[model samples]
Target: MTIAEHRTDTTHPLDPMTTAEVDAVREVLTRDGLLGEHVRFAYLGLREPGKRAVETFTGRADLDRRFLAILLDLGTGASRSVIVSTTRNTIDSTVDIDPATEGQPPIIDTEFELIEDILNADERWTAALAKRGLDPATVRAVPLSAGHYDEPGESGKRIVRSLGFQQFHEKDLPWAHPVDGLVAYVDLTGRRVTRIIDHHEYPVPQEQGNFDDPAFTGPARTTLKPIEISQPEGPSFTVEGSVVRWENWRLRLGFNEREGLTLHQLSFHDRPLLYRASIAEMVVPYADPSPVRFWQNYFDCGEYMFARYANSLELGCDCLGEIHYLDATVADDLGQPRTIRNAICMHEEDYGVLWKHTDLFSGTRETRRQRRLVISFFTTIGNYDYGFYWYLYLDGTIQLETKATGVTFTSAYPGADGAGFDYATEVAPGLGAPLHQHLFCARLDMTVDGDRNAVDEVEPERVPVGPGNPHGNAFRSRRIRLTSESVAGRLADNRAGRTWHILNPDKHNRFGQPVSYVLSPEGQPPLLADESSSIHARATFATKHLWVTRYAEEERYPAGDLVNQNPGGAGLPAWIAADRDIDGEDIVLWHSFGLTHVPRPEDWPVMPVDRAGFTLRPFGFFDRNPTLDVPSGGNGGHCAD
Candidate 1:
């Protein structure tokens, strides 16, 4: 049949089919019956007899056209069927097939009408979609490990307790306490807690006085024989009260709080005498104008004065140790005559208690009196490890004396009026400062108990010269004096006496070139009117042993021989080398001694105590090894020498 005729028959009023139904049926018949092609079909709609009919037709149709049919039926009896033909190329697959019943009219093409109806419908479908979106079935959950819940508390506390802890408390612990995670306790007694167990890598107990222990206690005591001397034959002197004088001999008194008393003098003695005459005088002021106190004061003051004078001379370096030859004949480890000026010595001294005063008054008129104690001592300096030996005597009246042996280099200024100046300022051009000078002689004399004449009558005894004594050096016997009229004359003759010349033709001077000559003169000599014949005199001879030459190459030289032959050139003892380099650079070493009683609270503004003499000597005088680059040991290693 023609398509228009088929549409009319199917769409007839009595046929119970609408216009859409007729159109759908006609299209399906044309595409499947008129043409051969494969197609699939299904049915979807509301539950009812109308839906059932549509599904049946869709399944039973084995035609080439695919019919996806949908049925809509309200429970109110009115129903519709839509047959969609897949063979048709249209925007929608729906074709309504419902007929009018009662007051409702048939829907012809309901596709657009159904869409509008859905837009006007209530929000049930939208709400249903939202509910489905939120359902738990949309996402999967991950399971946690079983080990996480195994413990009841924090992990750190469990570890600490696992180690070796019993009971613990968080209170009364330092902010940086070892066991910040856990605080362990030990024992307690009153305000003082006994102990605590720290959870640190290396735990230690906290206590007072754990590391402090005395290494020594009190003052060490020792003794030496009193030094006495016989008088010279020229003049005889006697002590009148505290004054002693004869010809050029003179004596005086001096005082110190620590040493209590002292006696000083200018005296003469024969060369055979082995001991020097040093007398002490003291005057102990009276608590009640007592004579005994007066004499005691004189004795104490005299002793202190004498000791100080002696100590000053004892610790000096005499120029009898070592001398270096800088000539071309010498070769060093670097195969060159070493060109460097350097000197060193290690010496020691002993200080002894002259007297000690344990009872002195303190406090003002309005305050209670306090007792103060005072101590005085004598000291001497000499070589070898820079010795310092001391003795203590505390029974009001005590005597002490010290003797030392070592080299003493005499400065150009050796008399009472002598003074030192900068080498550059004191020396003339074309001549260098003196090195390797020998100290020939040093002397001091004093009186005790206000005995001035005693110094003149008492002669200094000549001490026995030993094998290593400075006085025994052959070159140390020369003596030179500086005088105005003969200044130039003394300078020329003293060149060999006071100067060191560089003889190596290839050796570099301090300015870095070959050195031709060098010299150093003693200071200006005293005028005749200013000279004191009996005063203390220290004479130094310019010796050849103390000179060192700087070279441009590295070579080993006979250093031992150069030092051995020069006066004052003996190297310091081995033990002194422990903390110093004796072969390196030029340096000067100095040391001094002093005495004071044990401290007491009453002595708030402490009085100056008696200070002994001092001396300086070259210790380590050079740069360390220059050829090697040594690495430092982080924080722990032997300290630099």
Candidate 2:
């Protein structure tokens, strides 16, 4: 029972659960009387195999295939974490969750409608809307995660705070007309409204936010010509099931209901670099301190299950050129199998140049174009659409770019004469878009050459003119070994050019330097919420730019497992309290990077893509430029005036 039973059908140990497997899981739980009438699946996915199992796997039938499922009893406000063995047809274990202490499970899809039904039928909710001169039917209520504040009657309940937005027509953009100053707290287990908080009302903005409508966008511009990209010889990449190989890079793709796209067993030229990499968690915190919005914070991945909303990609729009798509399957609230088709898009893109030089003495020029394998997926969470892109370059460089787009989350402005609130921007006449921060944490389980690795905090500093150099222009790099978990928490200093190097102390390049890959940060502000705020305690992982901890199988998420109703001080902040030694041991790097968006006028209607991310480039991993052997070639699309 210690080893998860293997299946002959699975190709890899890390492959996600298939539709058939999810069905089997549901059947097993039902047969064991673990599933009740009101019990719903909150989370379900393959339990990852241990590191030894992953490394020693040989495409054989002997693999771990256990499944982890979180079930919530909406009728009783009870939650349980269950492990099921579909192969053995038995329940492995079940742990009950105390919401008042341990927190509740993630909010499921069925609960969304339940919240609306509870609010729509309540007289208090309708009367509040009538007070604002709005009809009940015209309001679209969106259930939001009720953050913990230890309030009376809400301290240990499964509650969802809902906001209303007026929609004149079925197709009307509801976000444009926010029913401000009114909030409803619905207890899902009780199937009733616990309370409604109504403050001073604000006028709903009447401007249309339907940018895609023909009337709003007007005529299309015909001046720009089309530029087509095609690969006549097909792409240089090959995909066999979940494993993908392109040039010197090879990796396996994994998708689950929580984390959308994950990369495992990533290697360059048959040498292991990363064991696993994924966006572990993301938080969206609004800065508005208004009574209704003061508690606005969202754990997109942990609370709402971010990957469940992954968009089915389309050609020439979501992807271009020679493309390959992969489908992801997950269980729904009823523990029924559901498949998202074309959820992953993989392709190759031509970058400007890998290397270029002109030898003046010989009057000769040399250039090698750069190309990268792109693995990406997009998820639309509420009013925001996020595209997560992972690029593996021929030059041994890895970069993750996150594109945030979609309509801005709006609030009705309180003032007249076009003035906006201090915490918000007047995107429209009476529409205010609150300032917010999108903080993302990426988990990098490093296996530089092997598993044993260490990190060094490197910063470029200018030398004093009096001591190290006569001139003031001298500069040097300062490297400090991050040997323990306590001191490894760090901040990114853009002025000093900070980066962290994950290196193998036992392995060295030809130059006798430790083989390593450096994480180059884009350097943005960390969590801006005050330390006293509840969100700051809950999302403590976002408070630091970098965190290095010894590898542990259970430390998959930066936020704790049950993040929906979690109070505070869990996940990264809790794990590091042990202050374990990390030097020359298997380590994982959690880098937090993102954007603090202050919405502009152009961001209204629909927003263009805003990108933020970090890069992992070879430092001393290679003796010299690894792409020197990249053949010189061009498409020969020269133009004449």
The candidate that wins on TM-score is 2
> How much lDDT does each candidate structure score?
0.21, 0.89
Q: Which stretches of candidate 1 lie over 4 Å from their true place?
A: 1-241, 244-250, 256-265, 269-480, 484-641
- lDDT (tens digit, per residue) of candidate 2 on 7-97: 3456777877887788778888887788889999999999997888787887656755789999988788888999987667678999998
Superposition error at 452 for model 2 (Å)? 1.1
* TM-score to true structure, per model: 0.14, 0.97
- Candidate 2 lDDT score relative to the true structure: 0.89
Q: Per-residue lDDT for 550-632 in model 1, tens only?
A: 11011111111111001111122211223332122211110111221222222111112222221111111112211122112
Q: In model 2, which residue pairs have backbone atoms overlapping below 3 Å?
A: none
lDDT at 149, model 1:
13
Per-model tally of clashing residue pairs: 91, 0
